[model samples]
Target: MNTGDLHLLTGAYVLHALPPEEHADFERHLPGCPSCSEEVRELAATTGKLASAVAVVPPPVLKQRVMARVAAERQAPPVVPRQSRRGGTRRGRALSRFALAASVAAAATFGSVALWQYQEAQDARDAARRTERRAADLASVLAAPDAKAVSGGFAKGATGTVVVSRTLDKAAFLASGLPNPPEGKVYQLWFADGGSMRSAGLMDVSGATGAAVMEGPLDGASGIGVTVEPAGGSAQPTSDPLALLTLPA
Candidate 1:
């Protein structure tokens, strides 16, 4: 996906309407692009609200009243529309994607917009706080004075890189083009030390890529490794590391 179209994807991404790869690409794009991230935050304000809100059953007579009213209303005359080619332009396609996403979001809350908006404001504030803390930590890792990067090829086409910073005693991992593990499995990160692999954390491959600031301190860790493990991870890797990158002392 091109950068131009990405600017138009915040709505669809929040709506979960984008395809898997496109979704991952947009996620990789988020941290670097403040405008796009802010747009996602704004568009996602109502996300959890929809799922958590209790469903209110309408009165049994409501449907009948609406049907009766509809039956009495006059039907509009049908007019054939002219055929037009609007798909050839780039901007038009992007706009169409955004419009469709916006329409879906709008339709879900059509009758309760006022009440929903009031509720969404609170959720939005909470989401914003969490996003800010994550952004701050990520910024620190990227800006670390002694940061160094080690790249790993987990698969033929996949690239994984671990950036460790001695100055901040922190490490961060980023990978793209990684295939998801088999059913009931997930990719877990490890700190290889003294011939032992201690779990760092699990890699989230829900998108086209995965990234995280490695858990635990960077002390005495010889290297970082990736492995396919059971869903919740394991005390020790049951298989060989797909990529074992020795960290610089």
Candidate 2:
């Protein structure tokens, strides 16, 4: 499956919510993509921790309240059926037509309201997901045994430092004390063998200490550099590096 398909179902797969068909599809793709597998494990572990922390306490009167409401609703007068009456008169036909129209209107209104509520709930879930992702990222960085702070020179008087780590599956870069770029520019990190370069991460230099971090697979990087580039960054550096550091392995 394509990267888009894998990402689309990653969250569901992490929670084990996919149907059998989709589960098989995700399994087929996982072995070929280490990044997807790592993200899935991170998400699943976070979700499992959350689940374990939650207490299960059904409301004491929940069943009774529900059954009482259901009974009351059942006792309510039945909606008049809209079928044509046998040997019906004009008035009877008019009543049936009115009832039919009312029923349709009610159903439409309820459906619209339900749709709106579902959309609102979905928006809430999206926001919660973003917060969870940010938290997970910070947690992962904090938990890494190899993560550490390092420093280097920048333009003339400017200087910067970054937290760096090389994990078995991925690399993480975090920098601070760097100046922000021009309005249309951004800060980008590069992986270099001292002579050649590869884009490591696209970054922002606006935090209090101008902190930004990127996590990606880099099994072959030898050194690292930071440069100022266009917002989305380029495949290669187009300007002199503002900071540079060498990776251990």
Candidate 3:
């Protein structure tokens, strides 16, 4: 099978749904592809946990009752009379078509669910990588010898701190005890010189606490300011800043 087809079978392989022939092919490919290997491992572990969580024991008499029913079913007479050769051929063809359609439908449903789950797993991995990068940037700024800290509150209850590396032109901001913005509004950051301002980044103030790291040429900036703006932020400050911190000369 091609790579695309083989990737789609990762979910099936984990669930033991693939045929023996395809299973062998996928096994050969699994060793060389880290993405597929990792996905299969995660899916297999999740499936095992789910299986172990729901353990149901049949009643002692359940097997005996099932065998009795099967014996009675085997003894029942056929509902339809034996057909002529041509009629038997037509009936067989119809049964084959019905079975094929049902199999296709079931396969489609399974493939869609597997694809969705894989996409969600990929999204989670991307978010985790972004968070790791952010943490690393914060650590670097904190460790810099020239780093400076500025703290203030935009409103009565909202307070935040900005840590800047004077030699590196990087900053990390952390805020806490902030109220949610008004409808259709968001918090935006700006690097301000004496006469003009440039946007540093935008922030979501929905939570009581939020943090972000900023990297740019900040040598010319005289101060950092925060303001309420429309979602996605603005090119310039459209309203008065809620808080401002002047950088030391």
Candidate 4:
């Protein structure tokens, strides 16, 4: 079968509705097609949820009526085959194939929608977790007993603050009102202890405001400086500091 036809079977395969021969063929094709495999998994999960959430029970008399009809049909005389109706047989087969294709298309559409919803939900959850972590980190810095704040301005519109916890050995840079860097340049932080300068970290100042947290031994640094450096930042300061703040003695 063509790839499109094989993909159409994913919904049926997930529900265990495929014939044994087709099922085996799909299973073999699955290892090489990640798209089909993921579709099957998502559809299976949706099916499981539907099964668990809905309970259905037929009327007790329905079974008796079905059996009675079956008996009546079995007792009726079989119709003789019409050999001259070859064209009718072909037309009937064509109709059957069309119906089967329509059903497969509908099932595939439903499965694709379910998969998209599942992925969107997953992405939302991940974003929430990241936001929570960032909030917690900011709160911890703000609540620190020994936290000290330093502020400075770089260019005309650029300004920022550095919050440091001497005892906790952590520092956070909150930058705002900074212009976007020129191409192939980025803002970098430096810790100067009078004798030497150590790279604190790089800052992503792509927007009007951004923040970066530095964790390490920051107790001895006498000053914090910000400068524009090459994209990834340099091991040593290659440009004059655009913004500087002196820590308390």
Candidate 5:
């Protein structure tokens, strides 16, 4: 019915997650949109590889949760960027959290402090690898050669910024001094193209400041718009925007 964000359905189509009606819509959509078609091909190929790589398939619920998280958020945890207007270091908090997770996982597995200490070297290496990978993913756009950052203001001292890199096909949405989203709503980003927009996933914002790596690529998107959407992001923005920041060509 609503083919507005048919591009966002690639993942669902690949996983057979779309409802019958929406599946029909997407099938109709897949013919003409090269980007969505290409994405579906790549994703389907990857899905095949992953399916064959594992000896056993995951439970349906686990698969659903994984797909939901990827489709909904696809965001890095909130971290103050190096150029944060509020003026703070970036990366440290995220890295610390990763290390903390590693230590917790180690403790849970070993169940004894001495046992954890015995495996300290191996665990530390695992933690280092995890943190490195996460930080790299989060900073991909920020560190890109063509990265550009823009800032704008919001009501009640709140402010927003967007950093984009067409080269990296990524963008980061950052904000400060905003209230938590209304109970069932979340901050959603859009790739503004003229009057139309496409979903760019959701953010996990919780306090005075937040930052997230937006979902989807930057091509064809003229700017970024933020809005409050129902929990697992929307196919299109449903509310007035909290901020709109244009990107350079």
Candidate 6:
């Protein structure tokens, strides 16, 4: 019922070999346990891939061969010694609780690792999707009859110009006057259409004049915005945007 036991059964669960009672218990637990569910999902995905890579069928004589090997090795001495611990009944109960707690902690650690890996995989997939969308937008812009290279800058100390040309399915964001981010922080670029925003990429603000070029299919995109975010940009902007450029839609 706890995480450690779930971790121990992850492989067997993926293989559909868990005992009926344990399998039912896990099904009930997984819905409320995000970490364990994530691990199970990732493990299942991995095992599915492995299954496709190899076709393994035991040979017809495998049972006979296994029996022969077992007979030859049966002569070996017992590896594990049989021993019994001496303890009070109360001490034994305490030990049982200790073991359960330890198992839970172990399961939590494993669940964390598995969830982290799954997140990495999900991020990679999102990035790929963004790239594809960007490409399509650029292609559309470049195909426009009036599309030509245009350059513009801010009215005050803020500076930079974007080269927008319908001849190419892409736009370049060139800027300066942005301050460098503090440790563990980053400048993030965003694409805005009327309804929502999407992360373009994390920008480096270490230099006086910073330029992060984003190439994506604009697909009726209205403008570009930049903000200070954590190391990785979020799906939604949390603070006021540092700069905004109206797209030559």
- The models' CA-based lDDT, in order, is 0.71, 0.58, 0.68, 0.68, 0.68, 0.58
Best by lDDT: 1
Worst 10 residues of 3 by lDDT: 73-82
What digit string (tens of lDDT, one per residue) describes model 5 on residues 37-97? 7656755665554444333334657546644544453322222233541322233333323
CA deviation > 4 Å runs, candidate 4: 1-85, 181-207, 215-223, 228-241, 246-249
Q: Candidate 6, residues 63-89: lDDT per residue as tens digits?
A: 466345434532211112123122333
Q: If both were scored by TM-score, which would come out higher, candidate 3 or candidate 6? A: 3
Q: Candidate 4's residue-wise lDDT over 53-104, tens digit each?
A: 2223336674466345434532211111365235444543343334334434
Each model's TM-score? 0.49, 0.45, 0.62, 0.51, 0.47, 0.38
Q: Which pairs clash inside model 6?
A: 134-216, 134-217, 135-217, 137-217, 137-218, 138-169, 138-217, 142-166
- Residue pairs clashing in model 2 are none
Provide C-alpha RMSD values for all models, in order.
21.3, 22.6, 16.7, 16.1, 31.0, 18.0
Model 5 global lDDT (CA atoms, 0 to 1): 0.68
> Residue-wise lDDT of candidate 3 within 49-111, one digit each (tens)?
433422243366744663454335322111223443355445433443333233334444454
Runs with alpha carbons beyond 4 Å of true place in candidate 6? 1-156
- Cα misplacement distance, residue 76 of candidate 5 (Å): 63
Comparison by TM-score, 2 against 4, better one: 4
Candidate 4 Cα lDDT to native: 0.68
Tens-digit lDDT string for candidate 1 (1-249): 666556566667777779999999989988887766765664465444433443443466754664464345432211112232233244534453444346435544553565567668868999999778866876798788888887868766888888888988988888898887899999999998787888898878856688888888887999999999998999999888888888865
